[model samples]
Target: MAEWVPVFRGEELPPGLMRVVTIGDQRILVANVEGTFYAIGAVCTHTEGYLDEGYIEDRTVVCPIHFSRFSLISGEVVEGPAEEPEPTYPVEVRNGIVYVQR
Candidate 1:
């Protein structure tokens, strides 16, 4: 099992925002959707599109390069150019701190 690592203070990320964080050589995209936190791979599966450069549409993150829409909840492909799912990390909030587990 992977241990959870503190990524950010809960107040740092408000609702409807996305941030890039690095944890022990792993680059992860942390998204805040109405107070719910989700962490996903920063790299797009189809191409080398940087996910952090993409915009969030509702619960999906659109790839900036090819415009692939990836579900934030399941990391599944909502729209294509990408057939693979993005890897999502487990997230939790405690006492105003956000933690992400690989």
Candidate 2:
């Protein structure tokens, strides 16, 4: 029953940036890495830190609370206080817009 939802214009998020978006009740974290877009659960696995408030380093997002690092593309925990990997969603771009499948 899932479908792709348009979240933002592709140009709104530049490389090395992230944003938090709400799609019908689900909160998601979106990132841009060198032009490719990625989507993941918005909350950090360890302490529920808002990932949109996190810092970007290389391809990783560092949680602002406990400094946990997660891969922007895979949502794998790169460095932690977090042992669980974040839930990653499929992302696509079409007609100069970015969409996420939930």
Steric overlap count per candidate = 0, 0
Give lDDT tens digits, candidate 2, residues 9-91. Answer: 99999998889989888889999888988888899999999988988888888999999999887889999889999989999
Candidate 1 worst ten-residue window by lDDT? 41-50
Model 1 TM-score relative to the real fold: 0.95
Clash list (residue pairs), candidate 2: none
Clashing residue pairs in candidate 1, if any? none
What shift in Å separates residue 27 of candidate 1 from its native position after superposition?
1.0
Estimate the TM-score of every prediction: 0.95, 0.94
Q: Against the unseen true structure, what C-alpha lDDT does each candidate score?
A: 0.92, 0.91
Model 2 weakest 10-residue run by lDDT: 51-60
The parts of candidate 2 lying over 4 Å away from their true place are none
